[model samples]
Target chain A: MAEKDGDENKVAKQDQLPADKTQTVDSTSGTTQDASHEVQQELVPSDARELEVVDVREGAFGVRGTGDTSGYGGLTRPVMMPGAAQPPFGGWFDEVHDRLQTLTDSHDDRVIEKVVVDRGELTFFIRRHALLEVVTHLRNDDALRFEFCSSISGVHFPHESGRELHVVYHLLSMTHRRRIRLEVTCPDDDPHVPSVVSIYPTADWHERETWDFFGIQFDGHPALTRILMPDDWQGHPQRKDYPLGGIPVEYKGGTIPSPEHRRSYS
Target chain B: MTTVNDPYAGTTESTEGPVFTVTGQDWDSVDASVVEGDRIVVNMGPQHPSTHGVLRLVLEIDGETVRDARPGIGYLHTGIEKNMEFRTWTQGVTFCTRMDYVAPFSNEAAYVAAVEKLLEIEDQVPEKAKIIRVLMLELNRISSHLVCIATGGMEIGALTVMTCGFRDRELILDCFEMISGLRMNHAYFRPGGVAQDLPAGAIEKLHSTVRLLKERLPEYAALCNANPIFKGRLKGVGHLDLAGCLALGLSGPVLRATGYDWDLRRTQPYWGYETYDFDVVTWDEPDAYGRFRVRLEEMWQSLRIVEQATERLAVMEGEPVMVADKKIAWPAQLSVGADGQGNSAEHIRHIMGESMEALIHHFKIVTEGFRVPAGQAYAAIEAPRGEIGCHAVSDGGTRPYRVHFRDPSFVNLQGTSVMSEGGMLSDVIVAIASIDPVMGGVDR
Candidate 1:
């Protein structure tokens, strides 16, 4: 049956051939005839029904019947059933709560203050000094092998109390496909946190970027330097207090306004 | 030559010639052992090509080997995050698109999705708009990977491959130009819906181009993969295991190359990706070669998706690409003015003669954008390079309280040290290239 389909496909392709390729057409036709001859020798069942061949194009020498429609031309057909809906957020919240409880019981007391589960992810607020201990535990724990550090960013919250800046750590457990966030707060005067690069080497750049942008120093970092800005640049750019610069436009035909330019209402 | 008194040089007041007194009396006793050899400190960048865009690496070297590498960044800082805080919700799309110039569509999609979620308008977005966004993003992914392959080839001394890569990439860019007015920074994917429907002939052109790419991509694979020189340079170089990738928050091709089949499109399924039939290409090699194979295979998968999407688009013809909501989208056709700027005829007339209520609403929305309720949300999408996430905080304001982007290139670039530590200095180039860090994304 497959051999018969191949012969029909060859004939269909040969019908589309350009006029100059006569020799190639003859050779392809010969190959098809040879293939049919070989198939005739292998056939044994006399009771087999003859395979119907449909002439798709009359008088145009095109042979087209239902062949293997699973090849290149048949790829346009949608192949899979519709996917299931997204899992509810409540289950995700429960998992995060469970994980938080496990960490709180296992770790030192008075380190993790509260767990804020929002938008299907959990954020554990740890004291600045207890960050290293928590991260070490998270890394070494067999159940929570958060081997990846993903990102370390600092957010400045001048209006908040005990600490003005919140340093966030996004960690992932590749083994279980789970993610958790660890956040620690430090005062603006002394924005220092223990370096996690010693535990996960990937934190080197993330810490450096955090320091460069938010000015949150990561103590014990092997080589703390700016990873996005020049060393001589003044002020952390991402800090809320840092002033944004304006470029004076001179060659706009009509003067191009800077971002700070305000429109005058008539 | 005259002894010119340069005022700026050595002008600080001190006890004797700028604190030249020695504490240990080394000048009195001439000891050859006391004179230590000088160690040189050289600054590599802010301009060098290898440092990858305004990145300055301060190298402390003793002889040939580097003792320490201190990377300095922020030369390209444009304060985009802060600027987003000032802009209205719908206008934030333009600002986010500039964050990752290579894959602007992904940035736009992420920002739009976050806003849509905040507004609770996810279901309101038209299906045709979602399909259009998916098509644009997949095509953008192909172009972005082409750039990575081309630049990686150039960095590794295969100049011919760069030309081939860019030439193929141009075809995709041509399609982009036809759909979106601009080629690179297309703010075409707006909040609520796309800027407009797919232009005439775009679907047919995409169908043919995707078909051609499906046919021709194997040639690129055969050429680069079959070449022993290319393999020797790339294979086993810059190996970041799954542990390293997960630890560093690496996403996209880098994580997949380490054998993690975690694509947000497949796993999380945003923008109707759940309906698509495609595989997340992965490799267990965890090296530069593995990354290459993964990206190459992903391009093929993207083609498969584009083909399926184009076919689907053919059937869903004449559907509204924009949402019914007029608050977020302008209720007029945007056209290029004589000055080549976007202008709408209805917008001009509405401002002049519209009713007082309509004028006030337009004024407020145009000036302040839409308000997002006070809440915090984290939206993650699979960008061409990796996982691009936007963590937004809104305090019931017309603008975002805080918006942060988790750029994958920034996290992926950190693995460069792990890959290049004990290896030869030349391997650093190949390693960085294989990671395919975009400086715009990294710095942003």
Candidate 2:
């Protein structure tokens, strides 16, 4: 039986933008189209300068660079930042959200932040410290039995100051054939998050890997050593700030630029 | 042995001749002393001939029994995920294909599917492309499982099965080479569809390969099914029950062997797999033998799917293999010719000799990959080893913001310690063989 929680059980389905239309400028094409086009249709950009003026998203979005042989010169795509999804979460998403919200409210109040329903998948922005409690509840609650923690992946948002490192947990519910993502963030300088290995033992190696590539330390992981990078390697390679340069290979008449030297969309 | 000078032993003297403590007569005694007295730790290799590929295992052993087995990996870390961030979305396929090294098609399928989902173009991709994808995936499953069986057989000291498995696997690879012009790392699957349509005569070749596999698969069972030596080494060894599998996030045949019928192809049903008629094979023993049986039976199921796909493919000719939308698909059409494969001469002449717009369009799509709407999608396929997933995040950029793979080998390998901890030293190899951890997938 699901517990009765007053306001916590409310799945806040705010009126969201139409699910299909996202405002991403097609940098490849020179034209822009209004949202009236079919959901999948993309319009070419109108200006040729649009391909070179990528600096507009500087410091706010993905990397920007110059001098690339690849076609994208000035095009910049603006990614939507994570926010709360308006309610009537639709299909199984509303149920999963309410169950988690109620369960977390009864168990711990500091678990979730923003609930995003994008691409028909539900994502819970969880606080760094309450990961274990949240995961345990999600796995144990009969209605929300997300029995499998499918994977633990880390993403670094350089623009998101104070919370630059985000660790994502993709959980699967075999009983209901549902999937949910739990995202927790920590600052780049202090990237320490509580280990969810206690709830999902599968997170052991994955947590170690996150530590290896992104330098996010799992507070209670048994052995938080590097899994992919060598043990003595210094910097986490997957971080956005980490340079991509490698040993430059010599080809016939051309000096191939190392990734750091090559013009990338910084 | 001690009577000899032995100056080369007991020190780091690479400048001198290699260390040679063993004299002809002293070899047996040295082996005797280790087994009879002291506990010795064995380092299995960053290069062992059993063909797991660049994995090193340190087993602390007390005589013939292993006290503990610690895996030291990352010898094959290629920074593939990092490299993907630098390339356009389309080029990411080439890099991901090389990660698993074995199940190239599965990696491509998962990555492409994630990108398709992120771009919100899943429904728009041509139906012909989906059927071809299904065909390639099932065929890839057969080929990858064959390699697993081959290498697994060799690791367990069964030479005949290894030979038969590899020999049969070549039939599939040859078929792949004919279709995609490469056997192993076929970057055949692209974002919208495959890189190109199946080559001429590919259907007949695939049909022959399928028939040949049907005849050869049972020979493997006959050789190992009832053999006492084979069963003795595998049965009741490396026991990972359903609980162990679920706790560790293990999937594919390993979970199937534990009697959990959780194949993603059936449960989640990506790539129209739900429409296909096949049973999810499972076994209840939950041991090395169980995994072995599960893998064999799964191969049969893959073959069944492949046969069905080919039958449909035969009927569906002249259908577009790529998406209908011009922007999402690659610009140039490639054709196989007298010298291997390359861009079509006719398309090249058309762009160069006449149309300025066609040339510019080609330039833009080639240089900057198509932008995916900013969001994230986790697309998983039941790979030969287990659940291979691609978690793709696009920043509305031509390149991916981040791409992470839930490589099944990496997850299933957590069961290594659980399986080998209490077992005998020799069973360690059997356990590893059953888990079938591809080091490329593990270290990537």
Candidate 3:
């Protein structure tokens, strides 16, 4: 987990580079192939050439080391995270991105780490320190009035090393009838992200639920306690490392194995 | 008058005239401190019928006016989202359907939409499937609102409204049972398309359901629209204006009641909802009574959508309802048989005897499920309660990496304090009912 921190900084620094420079790095790396990748490269400016390879997965199923007895024993795939999108994001995305950039550029240039346009949805990877600033601007700004924060979902990626825990906020501009996602990441040891309850009051319970499930502490949240689970429960059950604990089932003739022990493809 | 030696005797003689000790009850054991100094802390539910499904409210009242109201939930948390991580993407519909049990199809539609979006097959989904989805979702909207109005009315001592509301809801459930086999938690909507085509005579049944609900819906308007007692109970109660609603992220009827035409079907327009002819109901009162009227009017609008969908389905007979994708779509063509619902006879014979590759394809798809590309997608649909959104993240695996639902019940419940405070204590029930939160969805 500690070693993952250096890898996180490397990726962050690479993303911080200029778009044209990153394209040169990608071309030299020679990982950009396939028809869809080529089309995407032509469509998006160099910054959104190809998604970042998060993990090089081995085997067809999730299980490793002979637990996977399926015929796809030698299959391997690269799990890619969407890379940053450049200008002319198409439709309202470019406008929102530009407006947000112009408004927040005075405070911190690195606030918006990456802008990803994947599957016709726009996502902004906001810095943890500037999450509140970007969110408030999105909600209150005249051109960018994302007045409604529809959801705040926390996702845990234990394999990602330092930035293992992520929080994704879905904001809907009811006035503009547009939707956008803002994501923030924190290391598991220091899983502290500033709370948005001050801006969007609806985030009160959502932040608590994120804390309860992934143990991502939303700093400055009022009375953050277990909302769904019992107060005495231990460990965040939704984390990737947490076990899906189940007991054997008793039947008329014999007992059956728990769900995790059962024959599963993934 | 009874002897002390007798086991059932109650009276005993004392130094004064006679001292009688009363047991088997705690009528006199009121803790003075709890209700002391004109500030009373009252705990309502975890079991009470009126709290709407195990919702516990801790309210502090100062002489009939509620000073603070805090809603305690999670009595029904089955960790549906967490459990979805272990199941296949197609099987996720079943788990989420049970979240808001009353509005199961809405949950399925929202979840399946997210899955389809993640798979990048949103357009490949059959046109007929989208229509049927719209049909079932509208029908479910009616049923869910019926339950809300029935239970909300019952909580406030309107027995006639409860009976009438449920009486009409049964007709909708009958339509669901005919089409989906099971009435609730049908898991009828698959990721690529629906689980099966409409059963025989499903169109006629749906048409009749719309016709029947159209006639029955007006009875509610007549019953409570102008009734003095009903108005006295709900009017001017739980007043939350448009600003408060926007701030709290309230949606559906609660937000609409604040006079905002913000229905997602009109604003976001998914599943061809833009083509449907209907009106977004709004009430400017911004109170419990306004929410009731909004729900009442929305039911009529849902009926209109259902009517339009049924008319369209009448002509769309014999059309394929599932996606044409061989790898992603479920192989089974379901048909009801003497034994039970299972694979159709022709489909079974084709896979079992006709083609060797077909059998292998069936086994692989059913056992392993198809893999979705590595990505994340969020899909939101306007459910009966509010905006139910599903955020699905896939790690290029068969199973979901993480699935989270922003249940409107859970989010709207946050307004319990803001809505009910500074109002009469009795209006707290009115406030919660107006929100129409299903605790199962709230805790999920």
**Best candidate per TM-score, number?**
3
lDDT of 2 by residue, A1-266 (tens): 01112123121111122344323333446355443454534232222111111112533123346454454654433344433555567788778777877877743435666667778778887776667888888999999999888899899987554566889999988888888899887877788898988888999999999999999999989878787786557899999889887878789987887755654443
Docking class of 3: medium
Q: Which stretches of candidate 1 lie over 4 Å from their true place?
A: A1-89, A106-109, A117-121, A137-145, A247-266, B1-46, B49-72, B330-333, B336-341, B346-351, B354-356
* Per-residue accuracy of model 1 over B1-444 as CA lDDT, tens digit each: 233343212334433233211122333333345434543345766687765566555554556555555455566767677787666676778888888888889888888887777666788999988998999999999998888888888878788878988988888989998888878888888778888777678888998888778776787798898799999998998888877777666778888888779888987789899999999999989888889989999998888888878888888887887778877664555666787746576676776687677777777667656656545566678998888877676655567766878888777776766776556556667787888877777777
lDDT values of the candidates? Answer: 0.69, 0.79, 0.84
Model 1 docking tier (incorrect/acceptable/medium/high): incorrect
DockQ of 1: 0.16
A163-257: candidate 3 lDDT, tens digit per residue: 78899999999889999999998888888999999999999999989989999989889867778887657899899888888899999989887
Error of 1 at A126 (Å): 3.1
Q: Write down the C-alpha DockQ for each prediction.
A: 0.16, 0.46, 0.57
lDDT of 1 at A146: 75
The model with the greatest lDDT is 3
